[model samples]
Target: MKIDIDYTPENKAVIHSYMRNVAQGNTAGAAADAAADAAKLYDAGSATVQVNSVVKAESEAGIDLKAGEVKVSTENQTTTNVSTYYKVPNDGKLEQL
Candidate 1:
């Protein structure tokens, strides 16, 4: 489904807050990660998204991938660029894949 988005001041404030928390390395809990992830998803553009597939990869860095695993795939209909992300169950964050 295509959802219309209105970039209001309040929304901007929330996104900014999430970015600040992420920059400060305060992603110890799932809230921070989820917020940051939402910001990133919004950045991806195009409200319509599809889960192409799930990916499982070995953890090279101990910082993002605490559980050493991820699951999820998305494709941007407008750009047709598939961006893969790693799902961290420990903190419920979608990291880079």
Candidate 2:
């Protein structure tokens, strides 16, 4: 969940101004500190959803993985029927995944 953000010049200028308001020493140092703190927060919030959460959502939507492929139903929460699978070997994404 590492982030690499290159702030546009205009945004960087605005951030420098804002950070200068509370700090007394070097303005660039203050802005770098602020950016570092923001990166930590951004990393913390940027995590892949837990496997259980994904499983629950897929279960609720009646999507299942079988034979190394995905099978979905026309209606949410309905049972899967092999004949109705939308994306398959003849259709793609399962192989891509």
- Maximum-lDDT candidate: 1
State the number of backbone clashes in model 1.
0
lDDT against the true structure, each candidate:
0.49, 0.39
The digit string of per-residue lDDT tens for model 2 on 1-97 reads 1323335553465445545644655566567766665543333332222111111123323445565655554423433322321222112222211
Tens-digit per-residue lDDT, 19-86, candidate 1: 66667777457575756666554653335433454444443332347766655544443333365554
Per-residue lDDT for 32 in model 1? 59
Local error of candidate 1 at 85, Å? 18
Compute the lDDT of residue 59 as modeled in candidate 1. Answer: 31
Over 4 Å off, model 1: 1-7, 29-46, 53-97
> What clash count goes with each model?
0, 0
Error of 2 at 93 (Å): 20
Candidate number of the best TM-score: 1
